[model samples]
Target: MHNAKPLPTYLVQRFQGWKATSYAENSAWYRRLASEGQHPRAMIISCCDSRVHVTSIFGADTGEFFIHRNIANLVPPYKPDGQQHGTSAAVEYAVTALKVAHVIVMGHSSCGGVKGCLDMCSGNAPQLEEKSSFVGRWMDILRPGYDRVVERKPDDMARALEKESVLVSLENLMTFPFVRAAVESQDLSIHGLWHDIGSGSLECYDPKANGYVVV
Candidate 1:
C-alpha cells in the first residue's frame, strides 16, 4: 500500500515555507492583519476534505473569510447538550462576534463523505469508538438528505444525493438561534455553493429558481 505518512510531513514543510515566504514578502500586511483582528467578509462552512480548502478555492488571503470545516461539510441542528459544539461555536463567533455579512455553505463534487452516503457504505459511517473518531458521527447530520434523495430520485443517484446534502445543511443552518436572528433581521445572508472540483468552477444555488446556476 502507498503509505500516507509522507504527505503530512510534506505539507508541514510546505506550510512552514509558505509562512516564511509570507513573512518575508508581506511582513507589514501580516503584522497589520494580526493586530487589526479578522474582519472577514464571509463565514464559510465547508468540508474537511484536504482537497477542498475554502481559502485556496476562493482565492482569499489571510483573514478574508472565517471558516469552519467538518466531515462532508455537515451542520447539525442547533443543539445545546453541553458539548463543545465546534461548528456552532464558530458560527456564533462569525455571526454574533465578527458580524460577517455573508455565510456560505459550500459542497463539492466527488466528496468521499457524500459518496459514502449515496452508497450506504458503513465503513465510512461515523461512530464514537474507543479511539474517538467523530467525523462519521458528525456526517450523520446529513443522513436525512441521503435518505430523502434516495426516496425522491431513485435514478441519477449521485447528483441527487450531493445536491440534497447541500439543501439539508442549508436548512440546518437556520436551526441556530443567532443565524436565524441575523437572517430574519437582514444582518446576514446565506448562500449555498456546489463546487465542481473537476472543472474548477462553482454553481451557486438560486432560491428563486429552486436550482443551481453556474456562477
Candidate 2:
C-alpha cells in the first residue's frame, strides 16, 4: 500500500478517452463478455518486447488470445517443485482450464533477451552470470538454444538464436504433464513462429520440411 500511487496523468487521460469512446460504443459487448467469460481459442506465448505488438500483429480483439509473455518468449522445462512458476502457471491454466486448442511460441527479431543470452553464453556479459539477477536466471531457459547455434557465422548468430528461442520453447512446453497430455489426446497443438520486426515478415516452423517457411 505504501508503494501504491495514483495513475499517471497521461494514462488516466487515455483511460478516460477509451471509456468515453470504445467502451461506450461496446458497452453491451463488454457486458456480454463479463457474463460469458473468456474462452480464447488459442494461447500465445510471446516475448515481453513492447515493440512486438501481439494484438496488432494478428489483428486480435479483446479476450481472443490468452497471452503469456516472458523474456525472449522462453518456456522453461517442466519443473514442478512447487516454486512460483509464472509461465508454467499460465500454460496450465490455458490448456487444462481454458482448453485452448493451440499454443504458439513466438519469437521476434532483435530481441534484447536473446542478445543477452548470446552475450551471457559467450562470457561477455558477466553481470548476467550472477545468481541474484532474475533476468539471468530466466534467460537460462535459452541456453540449450545457444549451444545449438554457437557455431553460426557472426552475421547470422543473433537471428539464428532468436529463431532457436521459439524452437527451444516449443520443445520445453511438452515437459509439462498437462500440456503433454493435451497434445497426446489431440486436444492441443503446439507451434513455433519467428517474426522480422522491421519487415513485418513471419516464418512458421514446418515439421515436414524441418525448417521455417515464410508465412
Candidate 3:
C-alpha cells in the first residue's frame, strides 16, 4: 500500500475553525457525550451523495443521530454467512446495541449509484456485470427495486428507481430479526424519505396514501 497522505490544507483549516467555534461553545456537552457514549434517537440510512446532508436537513446535533451511508443507500437482505457486511453490521449495532427509536432510509434525486443500477439492470453497464465489481455486487440488492420501477415511462424511470431504493431498503431492514423485534415491541419506527435536490424539497412515503407526500 502507498503511504497515507495528510489531510488537505482546506479541510484542516475547516476542522480547526470548527474546533475553535462549535467545539469551544459545546465543550461541556461534547465531554458529557464522550463519557456517557452516544445515545442517538434515530438511525439514518442515506445515500453517499455529497448533496444529501442528513444532519443539515434535520438541524440535528452531533450526537442526535446514528448515520450510515452507502451507494444509493441500499440495504441488503439479512444474510448470516460470516462474511463482512458493512451496512448490515451498522444496522445490527444500531438496532441491537443502541436500540435506536427510528430508522430512516433517505434517497435523493440525481444519484449516480441509482443511475448505475439503472444502467446495469438495463444491460447498458457491462463493467458492472462482472463478478469482481464491488459496486455492481452491492447494487444487486437494488435489483428488485429496479424491477418494480422498470415499467415506468423512460422520462420518469430514474426518479421512480430512486424512490424504490428507499422503499427496498425499508423492506430489507425488516428482514433483520432485531429490527423486526424492535418494531414489534413498539420501540422502533421505520421511515422512507426522498429529497429533491434541485427543488430543495423533502417528501415522506405515506403507506396510507400509497405515495410520497411533500414535507
Candidate 4:
C-alpha cells in the first residue's frame, strides 16, 4: 500500500474537468443510474486494446452495455472446474443474472494479443512459451483459432486469424449450458464482429456465407 501514490496530476485535472462539465450537466441521470441498477440490452466481450473503443464505436452511453475486456476477447469452453475463470464468470453474470438479450464478441484489426499468439505459434516469441507467463496461458485459448488459419495464404493470415478469434469466442459461448438454453428458446442471440479501427469498418459473421460480411 505504501507504493500506491495519489492520482497523477494530468488524470486529476481530467477528472476535475469531467466533474465540472459532463457530471455537472448530467448529475440527475447519474444519480438515477446509481439507484436503479443497470439493465443493459447487450453484453460485449471485446479485446482490452486501448485503441479498440467498443462504447464509442456503438455510441453507447453509461450502463448501456455489460462489457468484458480480455486479451483477445476469447470465451473458453464451459468447464465448471471450480477454477478462477474471470471471463466465464462475467459471462455467467451477464447471461444468467442480467439476462442480456444479446452477446457480442468483437475482434479488431492489428490486435496485439492476436499478434502475440501468431508469434508464439511460429516459435518467434519464446518468452510467451514459458510456463509462468500469464498472457501465454490466456492466449492458449486462441490456439485452436490460430491453428485453423495457419495454412491460409500468408498475406491473409493475420486478418483471417483476427476474425477467427471472434468466431472462436462465439462457438465457445454456446458451450455454456445456460447460453444454449437461452438461444434455443429465442431469449438470447449471439453475434461475432471484426472491426477495422483505422477505417472504422465492421464486418459481421454470416453463417450462410461462411464468412464475414461488411456491415
TM-scores of the candidates are: 0.85, 0.97, 0.97, 0.97
Residue-wise lDDT of candidate 3 within 4-119, one digit each (tens)? Answer: 89999999999999999999999999999999999999999998899999999999998999999999999999999999999999999999899899999999999999999999
lDDT of 4 at 103: 99
What does candidate 2's lDDT look like per residue over 55-172, in tens digits? 8999998889999999999999999898899999999999989999999999999999999999999999999999998999999989988988976654689999999999999999
Candidate 2 Cα errors over 4 Å, as ranges:
152-154
Q: On a 0 to 1 TM-score scale, where does candidate 1 land against the true structure?
A: 0.85
- Of 1 and 2, which scores higher on TM-score? 2
List model 4 lDDT by residue over 85-123, tens digit each.
999999999999999999999999999999999899889
lDDT on C-alpha atoms for all candidate structures: 0.81, 0.94, 0.94, 0.94
Candidate 3 to native Cα RMSD, angstroms: 1.2
User: Per-residue lDDT for 125 in model 2?
Assistant: 95
Residue 22 of model 2, lDDT score: 96
Q: What is the overall TM-score of model 2 with all chains considered together? A: 0.97
